[model samples]
Target: MPRLIWPLLAALLLGACASKPEESPERTEAAQYREAQSAMDANNYLTAIDRLKELEARFPYGRYAEQAQLDLIYAHFRSQEYPETVVAAQRFMRSYPAHPSLDYALYMRGLANFYMERSFFDSFMTTDKSARDLTSATDAFEDFERLVTRFPDSDYAPDARTRMVFIRNEMARHELHVARYYARRGAYIAAINRAQYVVQHYQRTPLVPEALAVMTAGYERLDQPELAAKSRRVLQENYPDSEYLDDDGQVDLAWWPREGKGLMSLLTFDLL
Candidate 1:
């Protein structure tokens, strides 16, 4: 009887233990931050983004708000939600202009716009981006410039400067692309204007020689022989070995910008 009673008591204790609900881990700002960080470490950017947003919402004035906001921007970027990254970055900058991570926000904002210029398909292809609409590229350049200008000593300033060069060149190439298109269509005045913009705004780029060539062609087509001669002379002097210049140092009248119609063109009817 005693043995049976002991077994029953043990069973009852086991049942009681099983019936008690397990305590949930306390949710705190730090705990949420750690969860988000873990998600980020795992490259689960979507989950990280959700956790970060929740953290920010639940503890707007919490000590981790600023860091969480910055992390949110990065997570959005990694998740390929470029527009969200930009918006979050912009919001952070507005909210905390004096924050030490302002440079980081500026850098990420620039990166977001940079990626926004290229669609997901464009990222995988080797197609030329200079022929596409460069509004986002222009915005990105401005953002990087702002970062470099405001925080010259920042860790991101060097990279920003480097990206600035690439953006400037892309913009110049875009202008040259427009110029060549106009020249091909016999819009000489418009062609010369676009080429001139490249020369004025995008100095030190390889596209300058091509811009000069376009200007020369446009001026010749417009019957402005003197202007054409001036442009040709500048091209000959600055770029003696320019591809647009013949062995005789004269501008090649038949040269046109090479256009690429890649997979993107097939899918988008060349709109991109």
Candidate 2:
């Protein structure tokens, strides 16, 4: 009731009235998600990624947290950050195995790995992708295979199937490339083993005939006449018109581009 006490009370009331109220957790989460979604709709993936990461951090157990994680994978992929895309996708899969979008996460992980070795300059270069190290391609193939096998009815299954085929072919071709490399270097046993890997694992691939040819040549060089005859017989039976076979039924490896130009370059992976 004192005059000085009344003034202090009035000041306190004014301060309380001017202070901002804290937003409810649910409302805050929803608003942040909306902002991220709007950025994505506008094709601002960088902004979306930032907002999505912040949402996940602030609302770790919030209702929109899982969805934010899922969007982070896609936004990283769209931004061409392949490694981050893979990490985000894999994290989502591990965090929410029972989520309805699990198939999407697997598919995106596969896609991210599939393009891991490629760069923007690849589009303008004529590099032989199959001849390069195919570790990422192999990983992508397994990811796609798992998706197709576990969620065959998922909307992503069809595309995963298609990518699986391409990866399989690339793997088979990579094995064949290694086989030819060993064969060219007169490492007969190594060449035969590599070629047989392709034959045993990639039965339906187009490169099977070439693998058989490598095996035949390698066996002949190793003085394994019976094995060479067996490989040649199989090639004749299954792929009589294969380009690797000459008119005399011999294994002709003259078609390799690197063989004609320089042996050192072929072995050094173009380091020359």
Candidate 3:
């Protein structure tokens, strides 16, 4: 029994010695970052995401951790996984509010929502979708505005500002589209409401002319000749060259009124 005990003890000691020591966490983190960078370079975003997440979870305490989280955002965005991009960007912003890379996080957050707001329906819908929900587009615009406000000197600011213009146009167009739809359906009051909203809230937008035109059309439909004339007066004053206006700079009563059928009217997008 004593001999057997000695052999068992020896075997246990040898097994312990043969087992590999735990690798240093710092080294592992560095390796993970390298791998992620390599994958990103190769455009293998999913692989980069896996390595970046692992690095972030294991080492949330230094520059490497911050880089990991930021890399995760780029990986998700490059992969066209927009929801994940938004989540990661928000998380980075929350965790590192004063991080030097905050501008990047904000820009990416806006970019994610920007893509989410884009859809084939918006581009090719038969009817204008002013009444359609524009929550995502509005959200993206806010994000961009915040980024521009907070980090005006950031390299991303110029692009963010440009995108803000696009978002503004989309929103204003949405309102004008709804107003036109309401006018077409003989819902003059609703048409006036939406058109008025665009003119008041979204001034300077390219859609302003369209909104004023809708207001004029709506008032005309409601048999309020005075109000209709007032709307036309505003439209002509602001947009003398507007296609919606006649040679006399009056709101064109001939165009939209001519199309009287089951088919929906289409609008050409002129956003910059």
Candidate 4:
């Protein structure tokens, strides 16, 4: 009898505790946010975006408004709606400049730009990104640089640094490709300038050896054997067994940029 009475009392307390007050606006707003987050977790990004936008609109200055705005950015990003993601990320940055999650907003902003430029077309194009215009990639580089500079210790900084490395390499390769084009066209001086840009500005990239090789080739064409020899020495010293070098450690002219394969290389770079 005592056990039955205790069980009944516990049930009554649990039911009272589970009972809620009338649905308040704040309560509704919180519920909406939870639902949106659940949708995001389920990979229903479109649904998450819709719910988040509603939360932001209905509770403009509400407790969850700013959070909703931030969530909207991620939802859009996950959906591959890069432009919308940037808009929402920018809005989040502006709305909460000092928010603890500000690093994430900046990372997402940069990531949006990164994805905007990383189209499927890249996989099929020549290695030459020069003519297609990489405004988005450049913008992403700047954004990632800022994130690294400001939030060096943040969790996202590591990924931002990795992205920066890739962007730097691609940009360096862009300059080298232009240099190769000029070298192929008998524009030795222009080729030298572009190659020098790669050597000086992008010294850490794989293209540095190629840049040195271009410099050697360009100087040879310009009838500057002294400078050509100097470039050859530097190339040999730094990249002794560089793929751009032959068994004799001389520049392998055959390694020069291909004449008409920028698009093909662009598409096949990662695949191959």
Candidate whose TM-score is highest:
1
lDDT of each: 0.88, 0.87, 0.83, 0.85
- Report the candidate with higher lDDT, 1 versus 3: 1
Poorly placed runs, candidate 3 (over 4 Å): 1-27, 120-132, 253-272
lDDT value, residue 197 of candidate 1: 94
Candidate 1: RMSD to truth: 6.3
Please report, as a residue range, the 10-residue window in candidate 1 with the lowest summed lDDT: 253-262
All models, RMSD in angstroms: 6.3, 5.1, 6.4, 11.3
lDDT of 4 by residue, 99-217 (tens): 99999999999999987966677657745555556788898999999999999999999999999999898888788777867766567899999999999998888889888988987
Ranking by TM-score: 1, 2, 3, 4
Candidate 4's C-alpha runs over 4 A off are 1-27, 121-132, 255-272
Count clashing residue pairs in model 2: 0
The number of residue pairs in model 4 that clash at the backbone is 7
What TM-score goes with each of the models? Answer: 0.85, 0.81, 0.79, 0.78
Tens-digit per-residue lDDT, 104-154, candidate 1: 999999999998978668766887887899999889999999998999999
Q: Which ten residues in a row have the lowest lDDT in candidate 3?
A: 263-272
Rank all candidate structures by their lDDT, best first, as comma-separated numbers: 1, 2, 4, 3
lDDT (Cα, 0-100) at 38 in candidate 3: 99
Report the Cα lDDT for residue 138, model 1: 88
Q: How many clashing pairs per prediction, in order?
A: 0, 0, 2, 7
Candidate 1 collision pairs: none
